[model samples]
Target: MSEQVFLLPDLGEGLTEAEIVEWRVAVGDTVTVDQSVVEVETAKAVVDVPCPYAGRVVALHGAAGEVRPVGQPLITVAPLDAASSPAGGEPAGHAVYREEERAGSGNVLIGYGTGHGGAGRRRRRPRLAGVDDSTRTAPLPAPTGAGATSAATDPPAVAPSSPGPAALSSPGPAAPARAGDGAALVISPIVRRLAREHGVDLATLAGTGPGGVIRRADVEAALGTAPAPDTARGLSAVPDPSPDNGTALPGAQPQDPTGGDVIVPLTGIRKAIADKLSRSRREIPEVTIWVDVDATGLLETRAAINAARPDQPVGLLALLARICLSGLRRFPQLNARVDTEGQRIVQSAGVHLGIAAQTDRGLVVPVLRDAQRLTTTELAAELAATTAAARAGTLAPARLTGGTFTLNNYGVFGVDGSTPIINHPEAALLGVGRIVDKPWVVDGQLAVRKVTQLSLTFDHRVCDGGVAGGFLRHVADCVEQPALLIATV
Candidate 1:
């Protein structure tokens, strides 16, 4: 049988090496063309590399967590037809192997390919059309009052009945009530932990989050202005309100603080993020520029649009995306990347905007392909899909890569401004801050207006300060006068 060697391909974004995360096929296992052979974690993302050859796996080069360079032999496959060669064809076999080696030399494994050369170009996928744009305006879950008694008093009909000793003691629906319905809150894990440590009841807090889902802000609001408990004065002791049913057993003793502590190993998404961010900081040189924008016009336009289409959930980010896309056309330099190997700048014809989403695992940037071509409603639908997939950890490898630019909204976190790190390989990244009422001079008169801060971080190697400033100004112009976006488009 003839043996064929499989080499690792460059996975693009200038990644030189990857750590093998898992091997789907073992020695003696059969693999087909385009079938995943192994999963590799790169500095940017986790991707499954498909076997280019169809044959039985003869050997694996290395185990998981071993970093291997690009274009190196990763595995060997013995083709089924190798035994049929004539005795005298040994010389011819060597020649064929050499030819195959040469052919695979320049081929990249996945998203990285020389088809576009040093340009780093990709074909834009068409946006999924005809989706309801109205859903973009869907209200986020609002904060609800914490505590069972508070919720029971507010919505008596929906509250669950107090289970008896037999029901409460059982490990079923009773667990939720015993936990004070805190589990029902849609807040993040960190928020939940904070609430528990501070003895805050999620049910008693009024939710300001979308869809009446209680958020961290709601919990803080509920605990507002309360005097700090003095632990030394014995004012810090709080009673546990868990139901005391006859069938329920006593709780376990608290562990010693000085005893052995838990050591949680970073794996999955967290590990992936650390590797990527470290690589980006080491490889890419980032420069940032901040601009203050008057968002009064944008706010008014959004309100009017929402009023006209009450069913759609239009968000501030969606509007900002539209403005950014419009600005990218005038300043296409911001829509490109610098190719250090070629010593030239490569411009992308299409706009794929990546939005940074914080999930339970880590930060994920899912691309909204062809953001420039999509309508406001279409963009909103795509953004929702990307974010939902990210939070669910179902985003495909392709969706996580090939971003022309990125947008990070720190406003949701209540931060007014921040200098965001640029997603490597992309020319620029935009950071949007919280909107607030601020005094501004409009037409020479001072007035209180809704305002926000926009910060742009770019690769100085490709774009100069002048170009970056121009791009920021362009985006600010569109956001301040959103009507101009429709007119220009």
Candidate 2:
């Protein structure tokens, strides 16, 4: 028998290490090629690392909750069919899965070579051995409409065949699934982890998602900790302190035993944000410019367009994005990045605009590709879809990268203005504040009009205050008289 070791491949986005969240397989279990054997949490997102070899698992390198560096041993498997081996192979029973031999899932992590339609393509999940076929049932067909399975219903059992919870190698505290209950129809590893943490029975809860898939909300609700309404939009509140108990609530850190201060560990998405913001502050020399504009015309223009379409209404952010595109056309310098290593400016030809969004996973900026080419309606649709994916934590890593400039609508936080930090490597960021009724001098008379603050924070290395001021002024002009867009649109 040939024992092949599977090394932990790079999880991409320059991440050096990952915390092993859970192991889906255990020693002595049979696994297929491209099967997800381990789940790891990186700085940005949680990812599933698929095994490249097909064989019986012999050894696991790391325990759950431990951090493993890239290129280290993750698992060892003994090939089921070894008699067909070549005459000359690696030294006695210590073989590594060669690059040519791997047939990986097409969802390739960066730096890892991608595989074609070999064992990588989607296929039916293999059933576990020793599990009776009668107990193993096919997954239930998804309900066609919402609330199809009412609260009165016991929620039908549509379990598929899996290795069961005992097969999972989790040293961390996690509730195991009951024996003979059948595998829960769960797709997300995060949801499973949350359910285990709270000791909630996955077999009991009815899935509200498509195809009877269980979502995080159902688990949270089962735990009796109602998620915030903003959670749907991807914004969640951070915990501070409790008056009576002196202990923080869930998602909050506990106070130190010394009775001095609370110690919150910096990790995951929060740490990533901290590192990027610090680097941006240390390396780039950024300048901020602001202007309070009369948005009366912008609001009226939106109302008129929505009235005409009625069904497909344009959002204010989309109109603002349209204006930003026009201004970038006039001042293309803003649509660029500074290359410190090459000691030169790297100007891009097209605008890949990044919209700053606050998600449950912290601040994530989803990029809209070829922003300059898309119409206002198209831009609106892209913005909505990207934001929704961000909230759902389903956005791909590629969508989070390759941004030329960023547009931050911090008005959702009810703030009037903010001198925001520029997304690293990007040349500029535009901030839009809340629009409110304020006194304005219009047509030589005092009038109450909708006014909002627009701030531009830009890299001085790419453009001086003159260019930055010009871009901000053009945006303000468009806000005051949206008809100015007709010239370019």
Candidate 3:
């Protein structure tokens, strides 16, 4: 039979490689055009790699947890009619393979060209035994806390892979383990790592997931009550082992040094973040400056807005974002970036504001396109939606890049101030600290006022302190006197 090998396609955002989280199609299983045959986790997102040819899978290239580079063969499929010869008298394998390629639906992964709509399916084509069309194209499960009814579906297309049978339906309790087989039906690396940390034997517990698969929640359940923050940080109560003379003391922690400490490899999004941050620090000469502002006026304005329109209350962050936009307009230098290779400070004409958001996956900055043009109400809505998408691990790669300037509200973390590292390629970042009641002199009288600190970190090469200070002062002025926003608002 003619075998056609499919290479891993670029999943966008210039990602060069992906880890094989799970194989959707096993050897000998027939797959149709545009049907998802493998699930891969790129640096940016976990995506399903669709099969371009309608054929039976003859070979699988990589195992779960193995990273594969772009342009490498992912799977090899033999067209169903490979044995039949064409009327042109070409080799049967070659002729059949050519026909299969011609019949391909030309559908690719997300953000790439896909012939099918969001349906992720095409018209019915020939199939083989052990292939169920319904389960192969099921939508990924919703993010936790979405309030959507949890349906038994494939784990997720944008999360760390969770492997199982093709169907999401439960197969009842798993049968008793056979000899020499002790690993449970667990797919998540986090779950496995956590279980190992807690010394929980997977072979001994009954999983609560579909088909008795072990889940993160199930492992936590077996550890009795949920783990407290500190305990959750590590399996044991011992703190991080202190180093002595630049060396780790033997037997000072949970794992013995003789056995070697865990060496977690940096991959996927974590690696990408590391590379960018390291480059920023190595290349950019940065300086930080901060100022404390009396935020009583901003608080009052926000409260009044909420009272006027409780249905669409504006968030404090949205107000601060508006202030940043105005500050950028006055001192555009802070909104520019140093194009080192190009040897120029490329100042963007419009503000592509980025909001630093923490998510289950990692820290991500989702950019709001043309943020300067949006009203406060529109800004609030976009902020809410972008932050939600970030937390849900569903923000598109495009939304996570191309930010000219960043607004970081570390206030949510209840911190007072931070000299945050600049997001790479961006010249500056504005950080807002928590607002709290503090004694302040107002109208020549001491009284409790809502006070917040604002810090700015900028690339020294992009602009001087005078420019940075002016931009920050403008923002602080807007915070202290909300009326200052009138001209720009």
lDDT of candidate 3 over 134-228, digit per residue (tens): 32333322322211211112212122222223332233333432212443555334454455545555555565654355566676676764333
Candidate 1 weakest ten by summed lDDT: 96-105
**Model 1, 143-162: lDDT tens per residue?**
22222222222222111211
- Counting clashing residue pairs in each candidate, in order, gives 33, 0, 0
Provide the clash count, candidate 1. 33
**Pairs clashing in candidate 3?**
none
TM-score-sorted candidate list, best first: 2, 3, 1
The lDDT of each candidate is: 0.59, 0.67, 0.65
The candidate maximizing lDDT is: 2
Report the number of the highest-TM-score candidate.
Answer: 2
TM-score of 2: 0.72
| Comparing 1 and 2 on TM-score, the stronger one | 2
